[model samples]
Target chain A: MAEIQLKDLAHSYAADPEHTTDYAIHQMNHVWEQGGAYALLGPSGCGKSTLLNIISGLVKPSHGSVLFDGVVMNDISPQDRNIAQVFQFPVIYDSMTVYDNLAFPLRNMKVIESEVDEKVRAVADILELNSILQQKANNLSADQKQKISMGRGLVRDDVSAILFDEPLTVIDPNLKWKLRRKLKQIHERYNLTMVYVTHDQLEASTFADKIALMYEGKIVQFGTPRELFENPNHTFVGYFIGSPGMNLLEIEVTAEGAKMGEITVCLNDQQRRLLKSAGNASLKLGIRPEFVQLSSQSNDESMPCTLVHTEDLGTYKIVTVMLGEHSIKVRLDEEQQVPEQNAYLNFPSQWLKFYADDYLIVTDETGDKS
Target chain B: MNKIQNNRAWFLVLPVFILVAFSAIIPLMTVVNYSVQDIFDQNNAYFVGVEWYRDVLQDPRLQDSLLRQFMYSGSVLAIEIPLGIAVALMMPTRGAMASLSLILLAIPLLIPWNVVGTIWQIFARADIGLLGYAINGMGIEYNYATNATDAWLTVVLMDVWHWTSLIALLCYSGLRAIPDAYYQAAKIDRASDWAIFKYIQLPKLKGVLIIGVLLRFMDSFMIYTEPFVLTGGGPGNSTTFLSQTLTKMAIGQFDIGPAAAFSMIYFLIVLLVSWLFFTTISQLDKNKT
Candidate 1:
């Protein structure tokens, strides 16, 4: 296994692309540590596949070198790179049996027949494909075909990594869970570096130890799921990771605190000082719905707002409240008391995130990553 | 909810039945009648049954032409299939060059079969034609009108020139239909060029190849117009295929009983071979997704 690194890498489909819009992947540097399970998560067309392909040597970047274990492999072909990739759809040799499909990569590498047989049988056993080892790949179900596709990589001894490009997309929902657990087992057993590319947050969070959240072709955050939920470095992360996402409100920075039309959101003196020194920049206050507090009556630490709507989500209740023009969503416990009218909302200072220009602004005593 | 079922779909197929009655059934019945009886006049006939069938089957001239027909079709397929695949693989896949190449390849297929024969007839003439003059210039004594081998070669070459494009076009579309992911996957698997073709490309093209093979086989088996135009059954029936021999028997010599029986046998052979080919290929590809 080798650590794959992207050093100032960028890609543009056009030959002589001048504008940033032409670039599918923006200039960036990232690293996938050896033997680590990582996810490159993004929305569609945000260049997740392009990044994955570059790492696997399916694509050569336009601007920068891809380094493997500190060696430049920019000129190496995919075959010589010794990386395997499972595509969005299962790509199996239709005429070959499951045994042959699992043994394909090693056979292509011209491994001896006895060793090839050993690896094939071992991989088939792990993938639970031993039962259908003699069956033609074309007759197997899609998930089985995908497992065979994965097994092609697992059979090889010299593979640097196995990249998964949304490999579970065509699987049934229940089968996806099974396959994911199988992948986790494979990763644990073999200690192979695996990078999974997907647009699904749940899949990324569950399957990856750390996720590189990409936005507009740039990796906006690289952290654990808990870290992303607790401390979002980019406003897009705050908006993208949670179920209902974070509720952001436009505010004006001042010496005392941020002004929201008629009321003020008090910040610590250090944050207030930072805002005062920054001087009249556009600002936003972001808080996750789960973190917001609801008070039935107007109090010293609460701001009175109109209760617009309430939704029961089986386990918890989310209540939308309006403070002037901004609609804010607050999550309350299922058994928690919620006042029909005159409900007040509190944005706990510890949970508040201040954004200057769609990015989190850090100051002294800002984030409690608990 | 109660469902209405009136077998209205059968009524929708009435037009096709009427069409088949006038187009296929009546003419075939007349031929069958002609084959089964000895007719002195329209009013007088005697049952002769399978006598014509036996006579047609035992005719040595027909037997010779049948062997020649198989040889001709076999040569056509053997030469054309591989050559077409090579040309298709070598052709540009996209952009202005690809379009231009496609248009150029379609040129031969667009020419009428008789026109193709006439073109080659003059083109391969010994004294005046470009091909024959060039060959004679190269010190080869080639004259199709007098030499049986030369005439056979000329007809086969002409057919190849006229029809290899059909196979090439079918394979080109098949190759283009393969997704880029397969190539990428093959590269990752470290498959050699030949391995990629043998495993991925050939297996994927089976559907298109089946269609091309069937089309070429049937068309070549029933081939008449091109050789007929060029050779006119030759100096001594040198390039006379089965259809030409049948034509000579039916129209030229007016052997009605024998010709009808021969026609029936010929039709059955085409139908049987085509069915065999279709079944074999589809069975091999039974579990295709």
Candidate 2:
């Protein structure tokens, strides 16, 4: 296995890209640690697939080099890269049986027949496809076909990494869970570096140790799921990660505190200092709906907002409150009480994230940009 | 639990019944009637048993034409299928170039059968045409009008030009239907070019190729127009396919009995061969053993 490094990588579908918007992937550097499970998470058309393809040498980046371990691999083709990739849809050779589909890669590399059979059988065993190994790949269900696709990568012993591009999109919910668990088990057993690309936050969070949140052709944040939830480094992550996501309001930074229009909302001492230091940049105050508390009556620490609506989710409730002209969502536990009237929104200072020009500006306790 | 049965659906089939009777069944039965009998006129007829069938089968002209038809159809399929697939492979897959290539390929298919015949007839003329003049200029004795080999060559080449596009179009559509992911996966797996074709492209193109093969076989077996116009079954009937022979006996000679029997045999051969092609190729994947 190898640590995949994308250094100064930029990709543009256009022959002459005039602006940053034309690039599918903007110039950036990132590294996937050897044997670590990482995810490229983003919404559709955010270049996650492009990044995965670039890593696999399927698509060449317009600028910069891809390094496997430490060697530059710019001119290396996908065939020479020793990378394995599972695609968005299950791709199998219909003329071949399940066994042959799994055995194909090893056979291509001129591995011996007995070794091919051993590896194929082992992978089939892990995917629980042993029973139908002799059957034609065309006859299997979507999930089993997908398993065959995944099995091809697993059968190869010398692959540097296995890339998955939304492999479970066609699978049913129950099978998706099983296949994901199987993938995790395979990772644990082989210690292969894996990068899964998906639009789904849940799939990203559950499958990868560190999720790289991408937006507008850039990696906005790369951290654990909890880190992304607790300390979103970008405004997009703050909006993208949670269920209702972090409620945000355009705020003006001042000497007293952050102001959301005429009323000034109270911020913690550290946050107030951070906002003041990040001067002249457009400011936004963000807090997860889960962190926002609802007070029955207005208080000095609370902002007065009208209770617009409440949605009763099975485990929790999301209440929408109109704070001036902005609608902010406040999530409450099933047992927690919502105000009858005169709702006051309390922004817990610790949970609040301040953004200057759409970037998270929070510093950890040690004065580091964590 | 008991379910109520509705017979109303059976009554709804009346329109289809009327359509099939007029279009297929009644006409087919009339041919069968004509094939088994000797009829001098509307008022005079006699049941001749299998006499006409036996006579038609023994006729050497009919036999020669059948053999020529088989060779022609075989040669057409052998040349066209691979060539069509190659052309399809070379075609652009997307964007403005793909659309332009598609339009250019469709030009041959859009020409009517007779028009194709007329075009090739003048185009292959030894004295005036470019192809014939160039071949002769290359120190080759080529005149489709007088030589049997030359006539056969022109007829086959004309047929290829007229119909290879159909197979190519079908194959192009088939190739386009395959996702880019297959090619990417193949590259990642380190599959050779030949291996990719053998495993991925060929297998995916199987369904469309079956249709292409069947259509090409049937159409080539019944080929009459371009050859008729270009060579006129000339050079001692070297290019006379089965349909030309059937047309000659039925309409040219007006021999009602044997011609009907000959036409009947022609129909059966096409039906049987089409059925064989369909079943054999369709079952190729299913019966792996």
Candidate 3:
């Protein structure tokens, strides 16, 4: 196993990238520690796959370098890098038996036949594919085929890392969960560095110890799932992580206080000073929907909001409330009652986050100003 | 729940039945009738009772031509399949060069069979032809008119030139149909070039190879026009195939009775071999799965 590092790595599919938008993967420095299970998470076309490909040595970056164990690996071939990649679609030798498919990588390295057989069997046993080892790979179910694809990677002991580019995409839903758990187990048993690229937050959170959230070809944030949920560094993260996501409202800073229409929000002295320094820059108040307290009676810190709709989602309810011109979603518990016409919505001070120019302003443990 | 039996479906199929009978069945029945009878004139004919079939089957001339047909078909398939696959593999996968290669390779296939034979006939002439003259200049006696080896080589070469492109095109299409993921996976697996070809490419090409093999086999087995135009079944009948022998018997000698019988046997042979080919390949496919 090796620590894979990207030293200001950037990639572009174009022959000449004239602008930042032209790059598929924007320049960034990141490291995946040895034996760490990391997920590269992003929306589609957000460069997660491109970053994964760069790490696997499939695509040469247009700028910077990829280093494995502190050694430059940009010029190395994928095979020489000793990295295994399971693609989005299951790729197997259609004519080969399941056993042979698992044994392929080992055989390619000229590993001894007996040892190859041993390794293949061990991988098959782990994948629960021993029963169909003699069966041709072409005839298996989609999930089983994907398992065989994963088995090919697992069978090779010399691989420094295994990269998965949404390898569970073609699998059935139930099987996807099972296979993900199996992969987690495999990662623990082998202590192999695995970098999973996916757009799914749930999958990333479950599979990875830390997730690198990419946006517009740049890694916007890299942290644990809890960190991402609790303290998103970018407005996109705030809007992307949760079910209904964090509710963001445009708040204009005035001499009196932060103002949202006629409702004046009470802010501390530091916040008022930061807002004053922020000048005319666009500022937003971000609070998770779960943290939005809804009550029938108005209070000192509460703003009156008209209830537009309430969706009972069995476990919890998503209540969309109109606060002046802004539509704010408040996630309420199953037992929480919705006000008939209007309600008082309160943004808890601790959970309240402030953003200037669409980026979360770094704050200390105690929520403060900029 | 009981299923409904639709007797009205036969009425719906009546038009197709008549069309097939007129197009295929009636003509085949006529051949069958001729094969079973010794026709002396327009009306006067005698019941042969498989007499013609016996004569044709035991005939040494037919046997020799049959063996020659098998050898020619087998040799052509053996040579063309590998050669076509190699040509396809060597071809550019994309861009202007791929299009140019495809157009260039398709030229020989576009030429008519008789025209190909005629072209080769003039092209391989000992005195004036470029090929024969070049061979003679290299101190090799290469007269296709009198030498059996030269005639056979010319015929096979001409066949290869005319048909290898068809196989190549099919194989090219097959190769193109394989996704890029397989290649990437193979690369990551550290598979050797030969191993990739053997394990990945060759197996993927099986579906198209089956079609190529069947087409080349059936076409080569019944080949008459090319050799007839070039060699005229001469050079001591060294290049005479079954179709040429059948054509000679039916049209040259007008031995309709034995020729018709031979035609039936030939049809059966082609059908049986095709069935065997399909079944064997399908069995191999099943065994793998």
Candidate 4:
């Protein structure tokens, strides 16, 4: 495995290069280190899959260069790239036995019969496909077929990397965990540079060592899952990565502090300076639902909100509230006593993120808002 | 959910079965009647029992025609199926080109069977036809009309031209139905082009190829119109396949008893062969179990 570098890589479906901004990827410059398990996570049509395909050599970028260990691979075919891919659905040969399906790539490379058998058996063992090795691949269930598809990719040890494009979409929810666990085990054992594309945050976070969160046609943020959750550079990432997502309430900033309607919340000196330097008139406050505390009685600094309803989701309750016209959600503790009609909303002492024009403005801990 | 009474569903299928029976059963019964009774004319007839069947079973002409039919179907299938797959593999997956290729392929299938024969007959003539003229111009003695080997070549070539496209189209449809993920999986496996075809494309194409084989087999084995129009079973009966032989006994000589026996033998051979093909393929599909 060698480091794959994307140098100002951008792509457009159009014939001519419009601009860097006009491209789907928009000048992405990053290195996926050798043996790293990375994920391109985003919603539909966000250019995450495009980036994955480019790395796999299935697609060529409109601008910049893709370098594999410092050698240009911009025009290299997928076969020449030494990469394997598992698709959204099963791609196993229906007529061939599971064993043959697994052995195919090895045979193509002109490996001896005994070696092919050994390798096929090894992959089949990893995939828990040993029981059905003699069976035809088409007769298998969707999950089994997908396993064969995965096995076909995994069987070849010579591949530089393996790519997955929503490989679990066709799999049953109950079986997904098992398959994912199996995949993780195989990745750990093989240490192939793996790039996965998925819209599911949980899948991305669980599978990838580092996640590249894409928005529109650009990578909004690339970081570890913990870093993404704790510190989002863009408001979109903050909103996208969390369940009950991050609440972004528009606020007005003045010389005194940040104001929402008649309420004015004071900011510390550094935060005030940061807001002043931001230059954008529009301000927004974002925080995870887990951080917001709800109570019956208001504190002097607490924001007032009307209790709408609460949804019991086993371990936690998602309490909905109407703050002016906007609905804010708070994840209330399962064991905590329910708050009354009028709930006072207290933003967590830490984890307050301030944004200006969709870009992060200030992320301060310790309630000081610096 | 409302419970559905499925008895009404059978009513929908009634018309189709009735139509098939009318087209199939009446002709079959008439053939049976002819196979048993010797009819000197429309008015004069006598019960021949199994005599006609025995005679037909013993005929060398019947044996030759049956053998030729199998050979023709076998050769055509062997050539067409793989060639079709190769052509399909080379075709574009999407866009105007795919649709254009489909329309172009469907043109030969749309032409009347008799017209295909006529077209080939004219197209392979030495004096006027381009193919014949070109071949002769190449300093090769080529006359499909007079030579047995040339006649066989012309017939086989015509068949390939007429039917290979059909198999290709079927294979193309199957290939199109394959999700892009499979290709990706193959790529990830580091599978070579031939490996992809053998393991991925070929397996995916089995259903279509089965249909192609069955359709081509039935058509080739019962081939009559084209050869009938082109050679008229000439060049010393070298191109007289089963259907043409049956036609001669049934229509030209009007020997109803023997003709009926001959046709039943022809029909049984087709039925038995087709059943064998179907069962064998289906069993192979099941063996993957």
Give the best candidate by TM-score: 3
lDDT of 3 by residue, B21-128 (tens): 999999998999999999889889999889999999999999999999999999999899999999999999999999999999999989988899899999999999
| True lDDT of residue A4, candidate 3 | 94
Candidate 4 wrong stretches, greater than 4 Å: A19-22, A362-370, B1-21, B40-45, B94-96
Candidate 4 lDDT over residue span B233-280, tens digit each: 878989999989988887888777898988888889889989999999
Give the number of the best model, judged by DockQ: 3
Each candidate: RMSD to true structure? 2.4, 2.2, 1.9, 3.6
- lDDT by residue for model 4 over A251-361, one digit each (tens)? 878776777776566676776777776786577878888888889888877878888899999999999887767788888789975687667888764567778888876
In model 3, the runs with Cα more than 4 Å from the true position are A260-264, A277-280, A363-370, B1-6
TM-score of chain B as predicted in candidate 3: 0.97
Q: Give the Å shift of residue A201 in candidate 2.
A: 1.0
Q: Which scores greater on DockQ, model 3 or model 4?
A: 3
Model 2 - which docking category? Answer: medium
**TM-score order of candidates, best first?**
3, 1, 2, 4
lDDT of 3 at A202: 94
- What CAPRI grade goes to candidate 4? medium
lDDT of 3 by residue, A1-370 (tens): 7999999999999999998889998889989999999999989999999899888888999999999999999999998998899999999999899999999999999999999999998998899999999988898898899899888989888887999999888889988899999999999999999999998999999999999999999989899999899888788999989989898878988776778887767787767665666567799988999999999988888888899999999999999998888899999999989987658988877787778887876535345322
Candidate 1 residues lying further than 4 Å off, grouped into runs, are A277-281, A364-370, B1-14, B286-289
**Superior by DockQ: candidate 1 or candidate 4:** 4
Best by lDDT: 3
Comparing 1 and 4 on lDDT, the stronger one: 1
